[model samples]
Structures are given as structure tokens and as C-alpha cells.
Target chain A: MFGEFNLIDKYFSARQAQRKDVHLTLGDDCAIVKAPDNVRIAISTDTLVAGTHFLPEANPAWVAHKALASNLSDLAAMGATPAWVSMALTLPHIDEAWLEPFCHAFFELANYYNIQLIGGDTTKGPLSITLTVQGFVPQDKVLLRNQAKVGDWVYVTGELGDSKAGLDVILAPEKRQEPFAAELEQRHYLSTPRILAGQALLNLASAAIDISDGLISDLGHILHQSQVGVSLDVNCLPMSKELRQFAPSIQVAQQYALTSGEEYELCFTVPAQNKGTLDSALAHCGTKVTCIGQIRPQGVFELLNNGQKLDWALSGYDHFKEVK
Target chain B: MFGEFNLIDKYFSARQAQRKDVHLTLGDDCAIVKAPDNVRIAISTDTLVAGTHFLPEANPAWVAHKALASNLSDLAAMGATPAWVSMALTLPHIDEAWLEPFCHAFFELANYYNIQLIGGDTTKGPLSITLTVQGFVPQDKVLLRNQAKVGDWVYVTGELGDSKAGLDVILAPEKRQEPFAAELEQRHYLSTPRILAGQALLNLASAAIDISDGLISDLGHILHQSQVGVSLDVNCLPMSKELRQFAPSIQVAQQYALTSGEEYELCFTVPAQNKGTLDSALAHCGTKVTCIGQIRPQGVFELLNNGQKLDWALSGYDHFKEVK
Candidate 1:
């Protein structure tokens, strides 16, 4: 008996909390928001399809979390403070049981980030979720991939490869009995966006990006944009105790840290002069930072094991390319 | 030859024209946009799915146009000027031939509206497009649905039933031999958002909404929000000559105008005193304005022909209810 409009009104609209900057909120054709003059709004969008982004039978709470988390991760990578988000959700059918947890987790995360749910669409289709997040960054403090200096030290926050390992366990459940299966499963379902760390690095880090596409392929984007190269130390790549224990072998651990993705960690570059301030700035932010590489003048990205270059065959996630 | 990233880089990214207010454009995690001090940003989002929102074999150009047009219409309804848009497009396969025209028409419309393509995601899934549009409206000029007062005159701009009539032709192609079949088909595929007229009415109209879900249903929104009611005159309902000529019967034409949706026309209310000003404001906007009814204190909406009530069975488009 609950229809589309009624479902949205009863569930989604009630969760749209009031914010001071919103001139017009939900129930209107569009939401009107007041933007501060000195800051520019950073905008990003992402779409999650049922089988592609997550397992069809995945927990609805995790699906909602991941949908919003990916977009917020983009804002964090851009050194922006999230302000508002709009979600277009298409579902195959209406199920109150499924939506109860989905909206609960989504609104919980939105409140945690201090971002308002402004406006969006709901339709019936093959299950998919598209989210657009907007945030504000003060002028001259916005981070860009092309700003990495040649002498900058490359750094990453938190452990990498955990999410990828978690995904592996899910993909092949027979492997779930591994050493760190529980930790990997948790990592896959719950990856936090480094919003505070990104903001703290705004005036300190030269360039930054979120590791959705893995470290090697993502750093390649910086190299392409800045016309610079990087020498990443394979030994220095940070891996959680769980990742190290769960990975089949040392080489597999390294590959997961370098190529397996959806970790939502910050990979950033700090100029040599700012090195002294980097550790102190992020110390109290609950996230740890590690220096793992250095920017180089050459236009190539290389992973070094000790002093020798390592030949890696695996690449990061590419939708169509992986299929072929 | 083209994967997700390559296709986006080769076609979509190149067409992102530079704007003075854009701090960061494509090739980054997010796009940074500047919003002027005295203006509030208007945000809206919409999703269009092939075989649902459009024909599976519909022209890609028209598909892209309708996707953007629908979101832009939301902004227009709020009396905001469009500034930026982000699209999340999911395609089952990579077809460069279809995309060539898709990008061409999409950018053509973006440039025409002075909006920039900031950032979005391209994924592999069932064919669907979700677009989020952002615009700016001066602090004092924002239009709202709840501002209409009892005794205000209700008005509608442009023809109301054309788009739905056009859809009728498309749905039943055997009727394509009807007198206005070509015009109806064109209207269905190419409905224009009333951006200019919305802006023109910003100061003169008391309450406004774009007609997406037919006049009766959409006006019900205004009535519900404003705590008022309406008495719509069937004789005053605007219909194109082509719609009248092509309709199988007069009742069918009236039904199409009343309940057939997706017209994208502006329906608004003006206080008695501002009637002269309203006429003068919209005089040169290239779209006709018609006085259709009057707002009433009672909280009910009714349609009448020659002052007699008519019982109609059709309701507006509700995704779940309609499907059921």
C-alpha cells in the first residue's frame, strides 16, 4: 500500500535535517542554499550499481554507507568541507525492511559529516544509487593533482589493501577462514573517508587524491597531471597487521597494497619544506600518516623494492577494461 | 578501443568549457565552483532510464537533452539561474557512435545555458543517466510553493498538453499518421524548460512550480504547500492547435492536458494587484501566459467545465502506484 511518493515522504524526507545555510529545503522543486562568498564549492558525483559496486545480497546498511562514503571521499581528497548531498536512488522494488536500515545508516553518516540531504529523485529501475556531494573550500587552499612539486615527499594515511582483501574474501567465501578474515570483512563493509585529514593537509600538502583506484594507478594520475614521476618504496607501503596476516604471500600483500583498491585513504604529496609540519598537523586527527615515496622530475611512476624496480602486472579497477 | 576513462577523457572532458567561477574543472577528484555573495545556490537532481524515461532505441541526442532539461526545469521552477551540472551515466556497453552525438547535444545545451560540466562518474551498468544541476538565485528573489495566498490568480505559461500528446504518438506509432503526429513526437522528445519565464516572474509571481506531473497534480502541490485550493477551468486549459487536431476526441485532449505529465511549463500564482505587472514582465519572454483559475481558502482542488465539476479517474505519475 506504501507508494513511491509516500515512501519518500515517510522515510527520506523526515531524515532531511534543517541547516542554517539552506534557504529552501526538501519538498520544493529544488533546494536553495546560501554559499559563503570566500569559499568555492567542490562538487563530485558517483554511481553504485547492484552487482558492479556491491554484491546483490550485500547488507543494505553497508550499501548505503558505501554510496555516500565514496562521494564524501572525493570531497575530502579535494580538501573541501562537505555541505550538502543529493541522492538519486533507483530500486527494483519497494521493501520497507530493506529501506529501514538503508535510510538509518545513510542519515547517520550524513549527520556525522554535517552535510544536509538537499534534493534528489527516486525511481523504479534496476537497482542503482547516484550521489552528488558539494562542499566548500577557502580560496587558494583547494588541493589539485597537478600541484605536486618534484621534490615533494609522497605520503599515505592509514593502512592500504584491507578493503581489497576484504572484497577478495567476499568474492570467494571459501577463503573466509583466513587469518584476518573478520578484520578484512569489517574493512570491506566500513571504510571511512579522511575528511579531517584532508582538511588538515589543505595548507600543508601540495597535492592529494583518495585511493579508490589503488596507490599505483592513482599516483599515476598525479604524475600525468604534474608532469612528474614518483619512486614508491614497496617495503614502505603501509599494510595493516590484518592485511599482512591475511594476504597469501609477501608478493600478494604488496600487490594488494599497490593495486587492489576502494580503501578510501588519502594519498598526498608534501613539499620537502613542509615535512616538519606534516606529522604534527595530522597527529591528533585519529588517522596516521606514513611517508612512502618521493616525487621525481622524470615522467614515469615506478615501484622500488630496495633499490631495484619491481615489475608489477596487476592494474587498478577499470570497469570496461577489466571485462575485456 | 574506448574504455570508461578513455571515453570520458576523449569526449566528455574535452568539452568542459572554462568558466571564470570554476576554480577546478575536470581531471580532478572534484570540481570547485564559486558562488557569488548575495545569491543562494539552487540544487536539483533527476534520473532517466532507457525503456522507462525514454524509448530503448530513442536517439541518444534527445535522450541526453531530456535528461538535462528535466533537472534544469527544477531550477527554473525555483526561479534560479542555472550555473553547473554533473552527470552520472551508466551504460551497458561502450558505443562511440552513440556517444559522439550524445556528448555533442549535451554540451551544446550546457553552453547555451552558461552551465559547466563539473565532475561525475561513468560506470558500466544498464543504460541510465542521473544529472545534478546547481544554480544561483538572489537572496530576496527565491520562489517557493507555499507563498501563494487565497484569492491569488493562478496562471500557466505555454501549452500544457503538447508533451503528453507527443508521448501518445510515440507510444502508439500506428497513430503516427494523425494530423499532428510529427509535432507531437517532437514535443515529446524535446520539451523545453521555462528558465527565462521563471526568472521573469521572480519578483511578480507569489508562488510558482513547473508542470512536470500535469497541472492538476502539480497544482495540488502548490495548494497543499500554501494551505489553499484551486478551481481550474477546463476551457482555459492551454493546448496547442496540433494537440487539438491530433486528439481522437475532445475528452482525450482534455485528459492529456489535465493528467498527462512532463510538460515542463511554469504554473504560478499572482496577487490581484500584480496582475498588470505580471503581464508586462512576461510580455516579451516568447512564451504565452494564460490565466487558468483562482486560489481559494478551502483545502481542496477541483476541475470544472462551464462551472460544473467533472469526475476524472487518472492520477499523476507515481512510480510505485503506477507500476502496481
Candidate 2:
């Protein structure tokens, strides 16, 4: 806290939003905000720790973007329109080089979503950032994981697994020379949170979740919550061209798609009746959509490729029990 | 995240408030809450790192209480009625022995305040707790530091410095033999958030702040924000009998009171005409109120003891420049 205000004024407070709803912003003990009437606010908190969520030596801008994007993704998964965020940032020490672009990328994303930076608590500690985001969701239109019924078609917005492939290059520099390395890295660092797709899925999709912990694992959340199972086809899983070219094989690229722990895509399930409307609803979002599976009756999860049963399997990097 | 849901269901979801405003609580991608019509929300975030904010060896219950109490203090400073909280808890590893008491104490205080635990994101990392709290306040009744004007009388609710003396016993066990040692530690570990006092002062106080970084340091915030200054008498500052008996001298006891970083007392400014109403407003809170300072003309801060204009100062543990 020794130069806390100066640091915030120099970097953070410099990025003010034209958000008129915020009555009090930074520099005060607390911030005051007004919520629009007739809407419920969806809220989520995410913490990214040095060496746990990202490498301490990683680019500050990427760290800031990833931290904010993940939280935005959480709100998106809940079909909420992003609005305001409060950050609790702990730093080992102040560094101008680090703070400049960190604030820049963070505000850049905030401005895109029209979200206001309402409150900030910066303290001295090992590097970590915890962000709490609140967004407005129409009172009657909330997407939840427990609503998918049997026979619902599982869908995902945008390609998956490219970021995992992208992360490999950052983790092992030799992968930098791999085919389409830059695009893969872009997938990892600038992963897009599917806010538009999530908002669009609110009425059409029965259940939704962000596929950060891999699709199968995250889709399992839907299965568990809804008390149903799914018959998923690996061939139907979406993949980026770069991920396919950079990965050793189509199978390996699909493997990456199945288990990469940082895709911000929305994995949702829609009934057959809404399938036609779903495509039209998402057409303007400019993000691809693919049907990956069908919800099955209770206790029946099957993996298929090209309508043929396969012994293929992929588990999360951790939490193997969740994979099944 | 292996057992994240189970942990939350066992500890957090068990402590739900009967608050009907909450649409959803823990156990989802995001929690949802609705704001009552015509009220703006007050928001704040506080991050407490082990060894930085609390000793790593401190009891889990104390850590939990201190962390939550400190955040409640921030919201109270803004004159907001506590409502909902979201926590991002990063633990080095999960231990039932540690988590049980930590969750118990956290919920005990939260339930006492009738705040809902809306959103939680638990992760694996070094121990740190970041809490974001939101409360409702009438739109026009916000008490901001910048609103204090010249001639306002400065008042603080309850005693200070005893917590600092209490911390001394915890830091060095030999001090445990000191008179009123148990009460001192209780002051440090179980400090109360002055919610009722803040709610009562909404219309009566010109400006306000929660005193955690000592009186002079926090009061300087008012001076800086209001563009005015104050003449405060240290001898008039309130002190507990326990702190007075424990300190080697009256001066030492006053020093402890002036610099303790853990007191949750509400330090506020009231216009001269509102003084009588202030006492009546805070009467039911069961806390002491003392007038120790008078606001001065712009940029003229003076510290006094008795009738003597003696130059005496105490800096924050860090941030020397913040102390006048």
C-alpha cells in the first residue's frame, strides 16, 4: 500500500468508462452502482494465481486479458450481459512496465463490453488477480446447467482445442516453429469469451456452460446437473485449421480439442424445435456452431465417431473422475 | 477443483440467508440477485494474503472473521446496508480441519449480518481470500469522503488501538501475560464491522471512512478528498480501559490506538447542527462516540494535545507520505 493510490491513479484510474450508472468509482472505500430495474444480476468471481493460472514471466497484457476474459466468460455462460467489474489485485511490487499494458489490455476488453471498473483493492503479495463481475440478465431468461432434457442436441460456439495447442508453443518455445504457430498462440493469449453466443443461447438453449475445462468435462456438468447422459461424436467436435495443421495428427488435434483447459466457447444444448431458430439467432455473431452430441436417457454416456462406436477417451488434465 | 462442488455445498451453501432477493446462490456457473427498486448498490473488494494480511499460523476462524469483517467495514464506510458477497478463495491445499472452522466463522458473521453468499470460485494456490461485497443504499444518502467541508466535527465510533495491543500478544506470546491480554486479542481477532453506526449516520454525517490504517492516515483521506484540513486532539481520542491498563504509559496506549491497522471503527465528519441528532442516531448501536477533531480551513492540518499545539505525528506502518 506504500504507493498504492499513485500507482492506481497513474495506471488504473486513467481508464475511465463513459458509464453513467456508476455513482462512485475508484479512490473511495467503496463504489456505488445502480442496477437497471426488471433485471436480475448474474455474478461470478475468478482467481488467477502466478505459476498456477499463468507463468509469472508471461506477458502482462495476456495475463490481464485472460483474467478478465475468463470472468466475462463465466457471466456469458450464465447468459448475462456484462456490466461492471471489481478487481482485487495483489502484486509483489509495483512495476511500470508491467502495469501499463496490464491496465491497457484490461480496459480494452472492458470498453468492448461496456463494463465499468467500479472498485479495486490493490495490496502487496505474490502476484494474483481476482475479479468479480456482475451482469444484467433478463429476469425470466436464465441459462442453467440443470435444464437440459433427454434428446437435447449438444452444441458449441466457435472452434475448441486450438488454445491448448497454442499454449504448448508458449510452454515449449520449440513449438514456436511449428506450422501456424502465431495463430495458435493468438488462440491461447487472446481467447474470445463468447458473450454474444451466450446471450443468443438464452431462449434457444436448454442448458449452457463455458468450455474452459474441456468440452467433455464441462458437458459432464450438464449431464450431472440434468441427470442425463450424452452420446458424443468426436468427428463432430469443432477444431480450427491452425490446430489441425500444428498438431501431429487429426487424432491428436481432436485430442487437444477434447482436453484443452482454456477454451472460452459456450457448450450448450438445444431442443430439436429450436435448432432452426438457433442458427438464425447466431448468424450475426459471426461464430461457427456445431452439434457435437445428443443427450441420452439416464446413466447412458457413449462416445461415437461417424455413427460408429469407438473406444476413444480423453480425461481432463486433472479431475479424471469428471471426464466420464 | 477436484471436489470444489462438494466443498462449497458442505460449507457455503449450508449457510444461505433467507434473503428472497437472491435468485441463485452457490453451485452454479454464476449466482443471481435482484436489486430492490430505487436503491443503488455499494460495492467493495478486499484481498487478504497469508503472511501479508494475516499470519499463516493464525487460527482459520480468526482469518475468516477478520477477512469478512474488514470487507463489511469497507461497505459500511459507504453507508450501505450489507446484502451479498462473492469470494474467490485460493488455498494451497484443502484440509478439512482448516476449512471447517474457516467456513464456520465466515458464515457465522455473514449470517449475523444477513448477507447472502452468492458466488464462490475456489482454486488451488497459496492461501489468500478475496471477497467482493455489495449492499444497498438509498440513492441520495451516500456518505463520501469528498463531502466533508471545513468546520465539520470529526467523530469516531468505538475505541481503537486495543486491537494493535491485542495483535502484540499474538505476535509475541510473552505479552499474553499483560493485563487484559485476552480482551486485547479479542479486539484484534473479532473486530466488529460498524454497520448499524454507518446506516444511522447516512443523513447525519458530512463524510465518513472506516479507520483501518490508523486515525491520522485514514483521516488524511478526508482532508485530501474534501480539500480541507482538520485540527485533531489525540488526548480526546477514545481509548478502551483495557488498552490504557496494558500500555506502559498513557502516551504508549494513545500511540497504539492511533496506529492500529485493524480497528473497524467508523471515523466520520458531522456538521455542527447535526451533532445532537448524531448521538441519538447511534444510541441503539451500543458503541461509544467521541468528537476528537474539528475541520479547519483548506489545507491547514494541525495535530494538538490538550491546549498545546505540539507537533506530534505517527506514520502508517508504510506509506509515510499519507500521514500528515
Q: Tell me the TM-score of model 1.
A: 0.95
Give each model's whole-structure lDDT. Answer: 0.84, 0.86
Best by TM-score: 2
Report how far off residue A142 is in candidate 2 (Å): 1.2
Q: Which runs of model 2 end up more than 4 angstroms from their true locations? A: A316-324, B316-324
Those runs of model 1 whose alpha carbons end farther than 4 Å from true positions after fitting are A316-324, B317-324
Local lDDT at A46 for model 1? 92
Model 1: per-residue Cα lDDT over A1-324, one tens digit each? 125567878878888767788877768899889888788889999999988889888889999999899889999998899999998998878978888999999999999999999888888788899999999898778888888988899999898899989998899889888778888987886889899999999989999999888887787777767778778898998899998888769889988998867888989999999999988888878998999999987545667898899777767423212222
DockQ of each: 0.84, 0.84
Candidate 2 recovers a fraction of native contacts equal to: 0.83
lDDT of 2 by residue, B151-229 (tens): 8999998898988888788888887887788888888878899998889889899999998888877887888888887
B115-191: candidate 1 lDDT, tens digit per residue:
88988888888899999999989887878899999889999988878888888789997989987899888888677
Candidate 1: deviation at residue A84, Å? 0.4
Any idea how many clashes model 1 has?
Answer: 1
The residue-level lDDT of candidate 2 at A240 comes to 83
